[model samples]
Target: MRTVARVIAELLVTFGLVLALLVAHLKWGTDDYTRRAQRGLSDELDKVWSAQSVVAVKPGRAHAVTPPAPAPAKGRPFAVLRVPRFGASWHFTAVEGVTDADLAKGPGHYPGTAQPGQVGNAVFSGHRTTYLAPFNRMGELVPGDEILVDTATLTHVYRVTGHRIVLPTDLSVLAPVPGRPGERARRASLTLTTCHPKYSAAYRLVVFAELSASRPRTT
Candidate 1:
């Protein structure tokens, strides 16, 4: 009886240590790696923008600028996203691909989707409760909130239009017109996607926005 009691106590202690380590990894280790990746991506974007002599427009001013002739290559850092509602310093580098590795770094742009400021849907996906929780507060966004996408040559501003919760297999939410498959795109739009219900991946939470204004980025 004494030996059995000691074994049980040891097992419980082992389990407790394992659980604590898992929580620490999720809380600190993942966030630290993600922050390092985000900082590296931001510096890469700065280098890309610095090579060009772009024009600048005053805030709230809408200007016409041509989108990049060709889309960025897969896994490349193309733009930075800023959500005013998140906070003044809250921003993330948006990479070109939406693969697991790409998203592990930060919010990633969906492949084949329209580029920012283009005449189609620009889709971005991020982790909701892990890897720095880039979109952890995505549900807090409401209509009229501003989302800014800064590229090498221009800054595209979009206003939140609506949001929806859909199944993981619902590809329509990623359509050119969002939720409308087979429809051609007529205007520039932005879509932010993240896992639903905070920590689960059983569903997707999508936030839709449309281009409100765009400005040139001054060199």
Candidate 2:
């Protein structure tokens, strides 16, 4: 009996140690790696900004003219995203694709979705528990909170409408009019997504916002 108990105890201890290591990697190790990746992406975004121009307009003074931009290459950084509710210093470069390799660097724009400021749903997905956890505090956001998307030509300012927890299989949120598939959209919308409840992909927690106003890129 003593030998059997000792063996079981040893196995349990080993399992616990492995779990701790995995948690540590998910919580801290990945953040360091993502921060370095973000720096590289930011450099690329700077180049895009230098090469592009927008007809400058003061915020809330004139309507923003959102001319379509060419589709960005996969894994390339195309925009800068900021949520003041996350933190004044919080930002992540918005990359072109939502592939694993692309999101490891920053929040990724869903391909085939509307680009920022376009009159359709522009979706972005990011990790909630690993790789900098860019959308970690998404639940704290309420209606009226701002989501800023800065592209080479304009800064789209989105206001939060609401949020929902949906099954991973839910595709309605990807509609041009979110949650209303098959409808034509006439206004720009934003959708941000991440795995729900943290450390699990069983469900998705999505935040919906609308383009309240936009301004020409000044910086």
Provide the TM-score for each candidate, comma-separated: 0.90, 0.89
Number of clashing residue pairs, candidate 1: 0
Give the alpha-carbon lDDT of every model.
0.89, 0.90
lDDT of 1 by residue, 1-219 (tens): 999999999999999999999989987888999999999988987877665444557798855444444567788788989999999879899898989889889999999888899899999999988889899999999999999999887789999999999999999988999999999999999999999988689999999999999997653
Clash pairs, model 1 backbone: none
Tell me, by lDDT, which candidate is best.
Answer: 2
Instruction: State candidate 2's TM-score.
Output: 0.89
Give stretches of model 2 more than 4 Å off: 54-68
